[model samples]
Target: MRIVLVLEYDGSNYCGWQSQSESCAIQDAVEKALSAIAKEDIRIVTAGRTDAGVHAFYQVVHFDTLTSRPLSAWVRGVNAFLPEDISILWAGEVPDDFHARYSAVERRYLYFLLNQSARPGVHHNKVGWFHVPLELETMQAAGKLLVGEHDFSSFRAAECQAKSPVRTITHLNIVRQGNLVVFDLRANSFLHHMVRNIIGCLVYIGKGKYSADWIDELLQHKNRTFAAPTFSAAGLYLAGVRYDPSWLIPEFSDFPIISNGVLR
Candidate 1:
């Protein structure tokens, strides 16, 4: 049967999602749990691979098994073997044709920032930091610039392997609550470092370093070097993945949550 597992993890301790020869990873940890339960080597194919120190709230992975394990067995079994940092939030039977990565119609990410002179407290590890106070309203206004189909060469990693630079930003809502400035962005897909790069540019705008009009010039140039430095990965999170509602797990259907995507 083909099964989909919803995952969440803190990416602070390990490398990216994919396992490497050097260090531990979120995939490696989840694979280990599956191996222990399935009593055979198992691997998970994720919806997307997050970079090191990046977090996820609703990451999805699909795997197959011949074992006739109960749904609870899939969930409890995997969770029992998993470490504190890596967790299997839920597991459900998905259609054979359903793929965790490709089937996703939309993927959303949130990059958090606490705009203040002082450092963050408990939530600091999960959010990005800015030393200078920013104009939240201006930043919110600037976010509108990125909401449309455009070639995002200026906002992607130079090493990005994606064939096309064109992508659609369905939503880009920047809102301020207290001292926290949250960037909510959703799209059909993303290029490498797209959100971080966008955030960097937006941050500069808030700091009065870049004018709202500058965005058009940057987009037209399509130069990666023209963008500000990519912001810290720590502040970013896979906020959610929206799939067909019919595939929802019975118990975890209502509350949407997942891992921190951190290594520790």
Candidate 2:
């Protein structure tokens, strides 16, 4: 049977989501706990691959197995063996055709940036910080220019292995309630370092380094080197992944109520 699971993890300590040679990868830990339950090898595929120091509020994955257990077992049982940073939130039976990566229609990300003089202490790895004050007005103007379908080559990583750089930005909203600026972006899909790289450019504009229209030029140039350096990964979060309603997967696209001095 095919199984789908929703996951939430603090990626500060893990070596990202994809399994690597090291045991510190989130996939290695999840597969280990799952293998224990199945009494056989268990491999899982995720909707998105987050870089190191990135967090996820709602990450989706799917795995296949012959062993049958209640859906709760995949949740509660798996959490028993998983570490404190990782967790299994929901589990359900999925059709053989359902895929965690390919079935996804849209993905949402929330970036928490501490825009203050003193660097963040309590939110250390949880947020990206910039000492200089940023203009929310200009950033919002620049973000609007980024909406719609375009070849995002300028904001993509040089080492990204994705075949196409053409991804649509369905939405991009930047809001700040104090020193914290929250970037809410929705895309059909994202390339490696795409969000962080875009954040770098937006920050550049917000800090008066570039005009709002500079992003327009970057999109036309399609040169990765012309863009700003990729911003810190600490602030990025895989907040949500949306799928077709026919699939019956849960919806978690809304931003959560944040406190803890990070938002306000």
Over the stretch 98-175, how does candidate 2's per-residue lDDT look in tens digits?
999999999989899999999999989999999999999999999999999999999999899999999999999998
Model 1: residues with Cα > 4 Å off, grouped in runs: 249-253, 256-264
In order of listing, the candidates' clash counts read: 18, 0
lDDT tens per residue, model 1, 1-264: 898888788888878898887648888888888988888788789888899899887788999887778878788888999878777777889879989888887888988888888887887578899989898778877788889999999999989999999999999988776777788899999999999999999999999998876788789999999889999998898867877777663322344443232212
Q: How accurate is candidate 2 locally (lDDT)?
A: 0.92
Clashing pairs in 2: none
Worst 10-residue lDDT window, candidate 1: 255-264
Model 2, position 198: C-alpha lDDT score:
94
lDDT of 2 at 164: 96
- lDDT values of the candidates? 0.83, 0.92
Q: What is the C-alpha RMSD of each candidate to the true structure, in Å?
A: 3.4, 2.0
